[model samples]
Target chain A: MSHTRYRVMEAGEARRFPPEAMARIEKILTRYPTKQAALLPVLWVAQETWGWISKEAGEEVARVLDLPPSHVDGVLTFYTMYNLRPVGKHLLQVCTSISCHLNGAESLLERCGKRLGIGLEETTADGKFTLVEVECIAGCDRAPSMMVNDQYFEPMDAGKLDALLDRLSREA
Target chain B: MEKVLTARIGKKDSRSIDTYLADGGYTGVKRVLTSGMTPEQVIEEVKKANVRGRGGAGFSAGVKWGFLPKDTKGKPIYLFCNADESEPGTFKDRLLMENDPHQLIEGMILASYAIRCRNAYIYIRGEFYDGARILERAIGEAYAKGYLGEKILGSRFSLDITVHRGAGAYICGEETGLIESIEGKRGQPRIKPPFPAVSGAFAAPTIVNNVETLCCVKHVIDRGAEWFLKIGRNEKNAGPKLFCISGHVNRPGVYEAAMGLPLKDLIFGAEYAQGMKGGKKIKAVIPGGASAPMLTAAEIDDCPLDFDGVAAKGSMLGSAAIVVINEDACIVDVAKNLSKFFSHESCGQCTPCREGTPWLYKVLTRIEAGQGRMEDIDLLARICNQMANGMTICVFADAAIAPPLSSVTKFRAEYEHHVTQKRCLVGARAAELVTV
Candidate 1:
């Protein structure tokens, strides 16, 4: 039951958003009547920029949206996608819900574990991929779906898995 | 059996506003605004059409819109589109959002006009990254074309649309939970009696409608109510419906057919699923999303695929997410998979849902893994009873109980087999211990 502890980055050491991201953040903020409504999107921008949501990034988001740091952490932890710890370059999320299960999502997951040389929720030694089983990604029509980062790879099998991993390795 | 909502889905540049305009889109809003039709008249048209919410509740959309108070001196009415398509087996809305984003925009604009709201928001699921990008571009197009954001069609009426993305909470699919999420809080449902129409989203008169329901609103205005009424099997269940047939089907995709279409046709018809994969015999069918109870092979024989039709057969067509299980599949494993999903997704706000869901999953997992005694079956039933029928803030608890309760009752023999034999009977060679 031991959990990996993440080093808390202080506010002074937090990476600031680039000029383009800052502008985009402002544009997103204008869409909502209240600055607080932009909390989730702002967190997304931070995660996209920093690879994962660090403690300082959370504080920065809180400061920009004028929310309490504790409030930002609570919201960030409540969601599964916002990774608090740094993950591998590619996050391979496989769907093992009922629809996907009926279509061999279990074996596909096993294949992913075997091929990646990592267990569920475990990252590879080289930090290339992290395999995790997710709930339905709403791709039931194309059962046995998996998401590599933000892109969805559906109706997948052993062959597709090999090709996908190879391509991702090349890109990395 | 004509496709009004998804007709332009697969075409080239289908997501563009220009394509939508060329194919007679935005006419509904134009007709409502320029024709000087009052909001009351628009509501009357929707009421006549009998369009129901497609976000699993199946409540009348017109009746829901009517719940808002007439007095709006200090309060601003808001419309929130429930685009969080996270129901386990549902993916029809993803198609609409990805391919025909403008149809939804038009629908939202028209619905906002009907509700007399200046601002509307599309609360989409975070996992739908591609769909969210598509919707954002579509909203931009809408604003540029003067279809959204102030003085639509050069009239006094003005409306603004915003697309908000949810991080990754399934409970946000619930309307009240969605409101809380948008308000920068945990996605948890609030108590009823002061419904969203009365006080929602920043303490304003808010109205939340499913993406499909609003799209139906657009068609109701464009094609007239009578045409919609004539498309379904009965008056109560009218309009073309999208049946998301997934799982062991040969052709697993979204099939748009008339309401109350026979379940058998959707599963076996060439236009639909075309029959079970590997030519296996149908074992069981989850007629709705994971929330709805499962129907056995014999029981689903003549059942119609509509809210009332499926409800009459002892299951609700919640989201029309049909997951077909073949003979090779084990019911115990299916139950365990769904129970795990509900347990993981439970917001843990209420004691029953937060505690009972994981408990059900634990027990079901034990039974599925062939480590259960006879007393454990009764324990599972008792736990399900504690979670059902208005025991919690939302129906998440009720949904969490559906798989174990219904599957145990109908497929008790399977559960008994897993208990007595200490191993799975069906698909034993293929079955592996699911690690989640």
Candidate 2:
């Protein structure tokens, strides 16, 4: 894993959420047929406010949705879209699932690890980047792929990853 | 040295099964057939190997199969391979079918044998015409070789596998919805607890596995269970997993690694991703897929690249395709775009999902277009709340609500700015130009 010591903000550093945020969450709960229906969105709000969904956040969502925290957590854990922790400035989501692997994604990821000076689950010293091995990213024609900051790049190689890192570092 | 599974793609003799056979194809199946591994033994081996589903869910394949009733009660056990790559930012399965269809066939056969399933189907997406065609032809080839029809590989067990093309609906990618579609019904999900394993296709005991999940059977059989278990870095979700990266990276494609590789390593490692586009800094990321929660740039260090890690972070290792966002991007616009997609794709069977989706889109769209009022933002949140938690069946409804709710909460300033200032505070005029 990356550095164990992530910069935790003091409780005072936590930004005060606009009152409307709570009102909005409440309104969303009413729109659902059942309060539990609002669980995902409630959790989403928690994640957005906290930057990641914590156990407390899950409980908050569960309470709003009239469900248990375990229930909310079960749903959160099943899907790929929820984030449980803080992410880096750059998220290196490498696709090694079947299609991408058949196209040489493993070597590409290995190459990325060597060049970037980080392994999966670890962030760069500057906290600028985090490399996560993903399932698939919907781009197979261009194999050996990775996604950086919501943009899709394909047919990646070690060299390409290196250049990208330099560019990200410089930009940061 | 190239791995055996990926050797056929972009190389000489990739499209033909004969070439695949020449290159050690079907050897795993033959081994399974000759080794006298019974269904129980096969299941045991798979469990021992610690293989999980490669599809977005990451469920244990052996455990899922174990859910089936022991011995058929004069009813055929059906197996359906979900080839619907409907999840946004997930396309690895399409390439596997396009390049090497036989590997899938052999793997499917092996899985069927292991589960004692006599009938199976591959429900492919309609958009993947080429993949469907290739896999259909491969099934034919398998039949010609006596590998798919009665008496597969001269074994007593007979199996029939067919490929069914699907109309373009994201919901069909869901397991029950896929089952419904295979049965020629609208692809709407069914309630659980008569899980497909217990009562599936034709109300018979059935097992549904993703294309990649079945394809992995060969790997498990070739290597012993112990060897397979040791492959993944994540002790729990053992063995290698594939990650398809797309987005504003230098090199975005697919890469395979042991489970639990750190997200940091995945990004910087070889063939992971080449930073952001146009030298822009990463602003946020959707680590799993489009449906996954967004990770702000500051929170990237919460967990490793495993199910537990993502779960702890309040997201999942869902079809772990990281959708990265750059500093130039507007979070509001992303919510709008995703909302529009889900709204457009909802089957309209459930009122909450059907109406809530479009309403959410309208609110997000309005907010993104600088046409939102303070109440509109609240409306978006309320609508999100209404549509979540299996409101519409499957996760699509909840998925529809996640982005907008999260966006409004995390980027309230942006939404408030839109309403208060009547313009995007990010100075993002280009973001508003999107139709959604």
Model 1, range B1-436, lDDT digits (tens) per residue?
7777789978889999998899888888888888999988888889899997888989999999999899976889999999999999999999999999998888888888888999899999989899999998999998898898778889988988888899888999999999999988878899996899999998899999999999899999898889888988888998989989898889999999999999999999988889988888777889999999988777778898888999998889999999998877778888989998998898878898888988988998898888998888989999999887988988888888988999888777778889999876564332232211
Q: Which residue runs does candidate 2 get wrong by more than 4 Å? A: A1-172, B1-7, B427-436
Calculate DockQ per candidate and list them: 0.61, 0.05
Native interface contacts kept by each candidate, as a fraction: 0.81, 0.10
Task: Look at candidate 2 and tell me the lDDT of residue B123.
Answer: 79
lDDT of 2 by residue, B380-430 (tens): 877778778756567778777767776666667777877888775553443
Model 1 pairs in collision: none
Give the root-mean-square deviation of each candidate in angstroms: 3.4, 20.0
Candidate 2: residue B51 Cα off by (Å): 2.1
Query: Can you write out model 2's per-residue Cα lDDT over A28-137, one digit (the tens) per residue?
Result: 55433346534545655666577666656666676655676677665555334455566778878887643355446778888777777899867778878878776544
